[model samples]
Target: MPDHPVPDPGRSLEGPLAPVTEEITAFDLPVTGTLPAELHGRYLRNGPNPLGLDDPVQHWFVGPGMVHGVRLRDGRAEWYRNRWVRSRQVAEALGERWAGGPVHAGMDFAANTHVIAHGGRTLATVEAGALPYELTDELETVGPCDFGGTLPGGYAAHTKLDRQTGDLHAVAYFWGWDHLQHVVVGPDGRVSSTTDVPVADGPMVHDFALTERYVVLLDLPVTFSMAAATAGSSLPYGWNPAHPARVGLLPREGTAREVRWSEVDPCWVFHTLNAYDDGDRVVVDLCRYGGSYDLSALSGQGPLTLDRWTVDPAAGRVGRQCLDDRPQELPRTDDRVVSRPHRYGYSVVTGEAGPATVRVDGSFADDAFTDALLKQDLATGRVEVHRFGRDAVVGEAVFAPSAPDAAEDDGYVLAFVHDPDRGATDLVVLAAQDFPGGPVARVHLPARVPLGFHGSWVPDR
Candidate 1:
């Protein structure tokens, strides 16, 4: 993870992205190997543990298609709440014998089988529903917005709650144009009324953000060409930071039309994968500039220039906090990572990087966190880097509550680490305070996870 000048940015790729040589870094993150081995054959206690994870599914993290309830006590680990019997017979009985349990053939892009489990007990979940917007006004107020329209798919959301109180907050990204939509839910489930946020219109939308009391929206540039879909990415594109970013709002009892907007172009990348508030001010791990290095563009060169930023919403300031020398990977995978597919040692020398051979110049940040794991201290410009050795990489990561009060370094760090050596992926956990000290445990998964989007930490509620 040293320094290298980004691929010389020049020319156009309006037609096709040129194929080039790859040069990515590999990772050897904290490891715990196989699930059963690490579980010490204790696959008995199933379900997520608030204190951390346990057998069957070690570590308290869930990816798409999974949602849970959590409970956190100051200085203690989290625990899954409301869970019951982990019975396969129960699940099958629920569907076949009874009528409540749902059965689906498989999974994909559709929001078909969203599961909400409380301590292994079935709760409210959606397999085929739009974003969860309880119309009772129990959550944040919602209405059509004028900024990015419903056409761009409006926004994508992930929700979390305050354990003691059922106070809920959802952070999402506007798909029409990159904007942050923050929604808060009270005890009665009443949500804050909201209005459309304004920003430079673009081709696609990414993720949104939320702190305790704020909603941050980011507006960036994206491109559209059928070609992008074929490669699993959209590049040769650019970004647009409209002078000032805005967040629209309305109180619970008020009309959605009465929403008030706040201007806050977060500090860095308009589309951040994940972040939380730093006190009153909103802190975002930002991503800047993005384009393409079609070998066709440079005749024979490859893609490289990818940078990251840290934005302070209160002051509307942007900081170029870290520069992941690998520009190729940033625009696609950001700072939030768990793991990637494993690639054997010898295959690497043969120019075969397994699945990641998708591109050349190794994995670098084009417009996101790149392949490097970066965490920034906004108050002091301090940055920490967890290099994923070689083609080995973690996808998105979720934080374990360090304390009931939410101490910055009090919780644990849980992620899915991609082990190319074994051609598989594993769920890994690490004490946040003991970060680089290594893993507390690793649970080998029964299957391989392709590059994933967002994830959550559902501790004991």
Candidate 2:
């Protein structure tokens, strides 16, 4: 570790993206507007909060994991809490022992990308082959979970839960491995199956899409680089033009050899909106970057837009057409309709128009902050935008249905929005059908929540 453990003065560390210092707990939060009487459960989001950076240069994506959770029940905001996932280094930094069990591939870093509840447990997850850390309902770190010792390898930051089968599916890639591993955890909280799909370069697979008959893999251009690793970069991956960009459709119940590879243009995808089987073809909607991981700039270059890829196995090609050219990321749809045809989708419009640049003192420019949320009606090609005022930052918007049999748009969209005016964060709830009509309720918090990755609305069953 470095002597001071301070972040290098070349990354974004100010404003809403700034990291918080300590854990906090607040209760009986004040709320504005009417709270839904039927809404019950916790809204949790995970993101990087660097305890200390030992590396010479730190990427914004590689910080230690911290989870912020707000509990709502019976039309009232009950509590809000934040806790760091207790990896060995994080525990030691806090003067506590590591709470997790044995790790795979010697990678026990913080699981700081997203959090979800499945099979009666809460798990904080990350990417690039880190095991998931289990947390209690109240946000206490329980330790790393390998599914009762049944998990064969590392876990992924993004896992898709099949509403029809009650199974969770993930695709994981390790730097040392030559192939990507597809893992399935059954509804019973155990690993049911594993399959290895070989590839050329060790591409950075941030997220994958799951459909009814296939697990979609994005083998893009960004890949592992030894030079970046030796250059003291915490995230040792960069854009590789030589590595061909392609998408793979692996049979849901078949081996790697059954995967049909379809060629697409060179691009990078960090998240997928959703995927579904359209006849014999597969349709996937995702946020696509023109390129990613500019090693010199240490940021992504080019505009990001929502694009749809139609994989035609009969033609051995993947066709892409831009649905919306607006710059955005972190797309989400109704989780229940994941891997199936549906209508409504939502995303946060990142204001960054080009490659993001950081200041010499590690501060980001004003354009780096996300300022609005948008709702897209795929059925009618309608889009609604909700601006959270200037300098306000918004995280991912997760949809929770009003009922088990609720209509596709009959739900609430929940997100954490930082209000520069109040200098605090709020859990803003908007009616899915009436989006852009202002939040129905804003549960104010005691502190600010930095802009983060994906999260889930864990409804009480």
Candidate 3:
């Protein structure tokens, strides 16, 4: 089967998308419109930021992780800060020894893909590697966390929280391991349980899904390849037709040995919007790609379409359908509605073009370079798009509830928009109820925040 070509690592580091060289902070950012008085939190985003300009990492995902954050309080944009996660590799690159602690043998640490706040601690995480690194509310590195040395192994970049139980769930896959571990971290920040699920090949499980009764895992065709590693490619995983494509549904309180695996057509899903228990079946909404990903190519594939998969555990079957044909990714719904039927979902509308040139990745490059924001009403089958026109690009729009008890969809959408024309970036806030009415406010940044993977809104307590 034909696969997409590899992306040029050097070219990925050029232009406005290039990683920042150093960390900096700015105070009292300018705003164009009135800030939301109810919005009191920090908008923090994480991405790969190499330690040196000449560092040669073949894939964009492997660079050192850095975080950019903007603090908001009482309708004021107080300050902005960017800092490296200070992983062992990053510390070594900076002529400093790893001061965090002794990492587990065979664990690689980057912690660059995502940043989240849980159990009164902020963490920077990367999948399939070392333990999560703790960060202060100010985004300073507190050190690596092993949940007081109780965490069994590496943590995943995408971990889901149970609103009712305050428990965190994750499925973790190591680089060469044939088995994946289902880990549960309790509300008090300790590993509650872990179950090892065996598989034929080590597939890259970027993200998983959570329902009220089940934990959904994707075992796709992308598998670890010895040939790719021997060839010195930075990303050693590639498409393998021999690998079976399936989804596993494990009961929330059950072990992996009790998992029911259902077969689905060969495809790849990097992110899951939401999943819910539909009586006897489980319904999952995600951004799905038809086949395997080409780690070498800049864009990867043509486009990822929003898809819905209905998994019937009793029949061991997965029924799939495309919800929308437009190229989009980074699907997010209101956190309060997670693991339940949700009415609204939002994603960045990615296009074929990059900031100033065509992206080498066969698909659109990053959410940060997307042309618009899309809001989908699952009940009405209606799609509303907020286009930024030609030169402006937007990142993931995280939904911020107006209050602790705000109604679903009664909130604001926050994202960072980079305008190439101005050579600057802005924190854009949109009223969720009013779809395409333009930004309610724009907080200007002194420098451009490069396109990145994931971010979150940490409300001030």
Candidate 4:
């Protein structure tokens, strides 16, 4: 796994190989055959951007919201952290939260710096770095203990920080979803190194997990993105993410051994399940299968139910042994959604659906969409979908770490919401005791965030 230098976009697209706009439509969004923009103002928007939750955070998972790198007094904003804003120098790069994006695209707006917390206290707020987030808790941008490698940048496709080893892990890819880039960051912000691995055939590595010993990934291979940029094409095609999907397991150390990839179709590669280690075996709940479908045809379609798969970390053995023949489905409105592995075996995601069909072009072709507070039982493979009845679109959700002596009633989930239809997006809170139902609260966001890629609760550990 060698790094294939990402060629300059202008140099790659010229002559006949240039990407045609028509061809790019396929690579922009996944899950085709829905509907078109005819539903704009009615469902989408045609006005002069009436909603002013401007430059809000896009796709993400949640950590408690903090102010000035400190936990804030208000609940309206939990830090929904991800790679929406990075230091990439590419122009065509599309920002938003898709696993892959336009050559040079992004926003300078940041809601709250993505921070790691201990209960209600702030430990670190790392800006997007090539390796894990920078340890901006109390240091300069450079020098010792700094993540200095250059990541894909532009709202990086995906990232994961291993809880076991405290090694920050991020995923980077050039194109064709065939290659894998793993960046590890130490607690001091010092980067280990970057390594290339095999990925399923798609444009993005939809989701990934980092453990004390291994790095697991679900690669949605649409690898031609780099080739398209090099050729100066807006839309890069001629790639197949489904020839056979793969789940990979790699050693966490350097040039790890037993790196393996297997064919498996995960439904929501981006908005997916989490991986947990049970000692004797490692368990991962995979939301199988995704694509870059046309939005014009696939509007009005609901969310696709996802199958849960459990994998063996040592042997790379995979099986859909947990879910039913049909998986549980979350609401498919336009709100962003995210999930984290639960303590026992179940997983919880805070999300909501909207009436709008305008989703950001995430890292993969169909990388971006919306969701609700979804409660899933991995063992029996049952799902509970929580819809936004009050017209609220739940954004990122995380199971706040529970203290050893913490009361059960004190246990809760933290989240954010983006509701453009009502012209509002807010930070929110839900009690896990009553999750998928029960009591909920909303905090008005200081601004609107579209959607983001990967994030974590970083419980008060």
What TM-score would each prediction reach against the true structure? Answer: 0.47, 0.94, 0.92, 0.56
lDDT of 4 at 50: 9
Kindly report which residue pairs in candidate 3 clash with one another.
6-296, 6-297, 7-296, 7-297, 298-360, 298-361, 299-361, 299-362, 299-363, 300-362
Off by over 4 Å in 3: 1-12, 95-97, 255-257, 298-303, 352-368
Give model 3's TM-score versus the native structure.
Answer: 0.92
Q: Residue 358, candidate 2: how far off, in angstroms?
A: 6.8
Candidate numbers sorted by lDDT from highest down: 2, 3, 4, 1
Give per-residue lDDT, candidate 3, residue 214: 92
lDDT of 1 by residue, 1-461 (tens): 31111222221111011111111122233334322111110010112111111112211122112122222233222222222111223223223221122222221111211222222222222211134211111111121121222212222333434434455444444333343444454444445433444434433333444433444454433323335436543132322333344443323233342434454432223234334444534444433323321221111122232333344544545544444333222222221221111110000011122112222221222222223454444345444555556656565454555434544555555555566677555566555555555566665543233333344443333
**Residue 317 error for model 3, in Å?**
1.4
Local accuracy of candidate 4 as per-residue lDDT tens digits, 261-324: 6556533344345555556355565443344432222222334334545666556567765352
Candidate 2 lDDT over residue span 1-461, tens digit each: 11123323323466666777667888899999988988888999999887665332256677788899999998999999988888998888777888759698999988999999888889999988889999999989899999889998898999999999999999999999999999999998899999999988798898999999999999998899999889876778888989999999999974344788988877778899999999999999998877554644434666678888999988998888888887777899999999899788899886556544444234664365467888988778888998778778888999988887998899899999998889989999999888988889999999888777879999896
The number of clashing residue pairs in each candidate reads: 85, 0, 10, 83
For model 2, where is the 10-residue window of minimal lDDT?
1-10
Cα displacement (Å) at residue 460, model 1: 1.5
Model 4: how far residue 3 lies from native, Å: 41
Clashes of 1: 85
Candidate 3 lDDT over 23-95, as tens digits, reads 6788898998989999999999998766563255456777767888999988999988888787776666666
Best of the candidates, lDDT: 2
